[model samples]
Target: MRGKRDIERELIHAEAKIESLQTLLESAQTDRQELKSQVTKLQDALVAARAPEAYRDQQIAKEEENRTPRDQAQIDKNRLIQKTTEGYMHALERPMDVDDLDALLARSSMHDIKGPPSLHGNDES
Candidate 1:
């Protein structure tokens, strides 16, 4: 049999691991909830978009009726923000006066393109 000190140390390490696992489990649960919410939103949008033209208006109205006034306001605000973002992207196609590429690098989350890391800090600047 192992010495008492060794047994106690092993028990302590096992307790620490149990605690770490519990923390990770809780974090995973929270992430799952977030993902479920996102999936539900996407599913609702997909249904609304794909419904037949005759039913589309009714489906949209039903969805809107289900939302609280504050939720509706937020939805409207999001749509406006999306439209403004698209306008900004279109504006970027016009001649940019900034001579330095570093100046362009200062913007985070390009409203125009994809695949670049969203780092805005002075990496090459």
Candidate 2:
């Protein structure tokens, strides 16, 4: 009976030791994976550093390719705005006939006349 108990005790201890080793093994595997990822990142950085001008040109080309559409859109927007603004300015600069002014004034309640004077003058009115 004593020998049987001793054997069982040794078996329990062996199992506990195996479990601890397995935990350590899992930890080591996780550490190894993290180290491998870090090494890969470091290798990429080293390669970029070795050929910096090539890397810079590649990055610049990529940026310009991305920016082309945005630049074109901005240019189109500016041209449209400028065209609309010029149309408004040209309309403001044109001389209005007194009859047209009288018709415009009749439709609205504004009594003040601050715009450019009629080309035909008050004699035409």
For all candidates, the clash counts are 0, 0
Where does candidate 2 clash, by residue pair?
Answer: none
lDDT of 2: 0.69
Please give, for residues 1-125, the per-residue lDDT of candidate 2 as tens digits.
Answer: 99999999999999999999999999999999999999987876886799986776566556656774666777677556655554445556877667655555544433354444554364433
- TM-score for all predictions? 0.41, 0.43
lDDT per residue as tens, model 1, 1-125: 46998999999999999999999999999999999999988876776677755356566567767876666678877566655665557658876553323344333234355323434333432
Off by over 4 Å in 1: 52-125
lDDT of each: 0.66, 0.69
Clashing pairs in 1: none
Candidate 2: list runs displaced more than 4 Å: 53-125
Candidate with best TM-score: 2
